[model samples]
Target: MEDSRDPQFASLSVGDSAVAVLVDRATDDADVIHDIELMTCSEYSHLCLGMPSDDTGDLAMYTNNKEMHAEDRLALWPAFHRDRLAADGRRFADEGYDFVVQHQVGSRFVDYMNHVGESTFGTPMPESLSVVEKFANTATTSHYLVLHQALMERRIPRGSKILMVPAASGVVTGFLSATVSSLEV
Candidate 1:
């Protein structure tokens, strides 16, 4: 399989809207592959075909996965979360993104992660927290849903730079950066 992080996979231009789909599990079963393709098409067909050509949005996506040494996933959450944020989170901030749509696994976890992010990035709490706080616990789809909510609410202005960090059980993390556009769902 091709690495989604490769520039060739995400060769987005200024006006392009990109979608990043990261599958942590790989299977050679034809049925499974068919199902995955069907799901992707069904879920994102609108974004792929309905977005206005004139909308000048910029999007970039990258995913990171740390090899697990411990059997218990929860045991490594804090360290993995903190370390990834310290590295990529700061880089994103330095690049001048408007805000991050952080994964809201839980209220306390989100707060803890935000504090860690602030300390690591040497910045105050981001305005994106409003979305996190509003929608308390969206498990796997926090990043995408939160971003959509923010865009729908007009909290993020057109052309604003945005970052989204979505993490999962395997310590899989994705960094998606996008520029807001006039395209509406």
Candidate 2:
């Protein structure tokens, strides 16, 4: 898993689109990685779902449970609003990165990465949306598709730096940051 990035790409980010998170997993000794933050448990109400039946005998209502599961997914959104990612992206900009890599799950996430990139550099930046556009979503491997697209398009400039923000779930909510170079990846 420690292989270098794929192309002249800047970075790669992965994970679920929900659950706001703040994490910096970049290391100076290594190439920067493109990553993201996501959580398996979204709504606080998601925490309320599928509990082991209480000995008190409360039968789980199928419809109610489903509704709760669906409606309560944004419970963690407050933490990762556009402003937060904007702020973090700015911090990345300040760190001297030239571009960013992100997950391409769909248009919303694509637009989101654009928003964050725009807010970070105070200008338009290249997006990694082509992968999702062409291949739809590949779940955890979506970032790789993005990197592959970046390589094919030659969008990344050699020696440029990139940022990543990835997501994860399964009861865990966090992010990993890494700096990657286009020349190497």
Candidate 3:
């Protein structure tokens, strides 16, 4: 286990963005609830935070006026991109991030976002598509897990700029950009 008092860990909190400590289950042992991985993130310098201008009105569309169905919501996803995600793509470019880590709701969603991203940014946004395809599941930790996977694979070079757009229930979306530090896994 890493100590929060350590300089390396403490340094993560110096950035403008809020620090997050991600804990994920690392073992299958029935008696080992304590066996886990602790990821101390927030090493990057904050660049920007973005949210949709019209959340309440937009949320209704996602919920289909409070009558949301899984299939209906999935079908409506393509239209949803025209709103916040499209705007965020421009923001991603304006903020000068080297790459983007989109919310991995599904493989199809990621691919669709990439397609939309190409149109919005005039070039394909580099993202971890393979991670989403391989994982094949959605979790709140998807972005963090994807980042950790990329870092572990050395795919994201040190000091590279990164943008993350994560969406959630109630039709909320968030855009966070930062410069990567020399964080070790």
The best candidate by TM-score is 3
**lDDT, candidate 3, residue 85?**
48
Q: Give the TM-score of candidate 1.
A: 0.48
lDDT by residue (15-72, candidate 2, tens digit) is 2333322346544545555445555554433333333233425333111322322323
Give each prediction's root-mean-square deviation over alpha carbons.
Answer: 18.6, 12.0, 17.6
| lDDT tens digits by residue: candidate 1, 1-185 | 15633322212322333445444343332212110000011322222232222333544322222222122323233344345546654342455567766677556556665566576555664565435567555555566677667767777766566666554433444455555554344
lDDT of 3 at 118: 64
Q: How many residue pairs clash in each candidate?
A: 0, 25, 0
TM-score quality measure for candidate 3: 0.50
Ranking by TM-score: 3, 1, 2
lDDT, candidate 2, equals: 0.45
In the predicted model 3, the residue pairs found to clash are none
On the 0 to 100 scale, the lDDT of residue 128 in model 3 is 40
Which is better, 1 or 2, measured by lDDT? 1
lDDT of 3 by residue, 118-174 (tens): 665565576542467767444566677777788888888776776666644334444
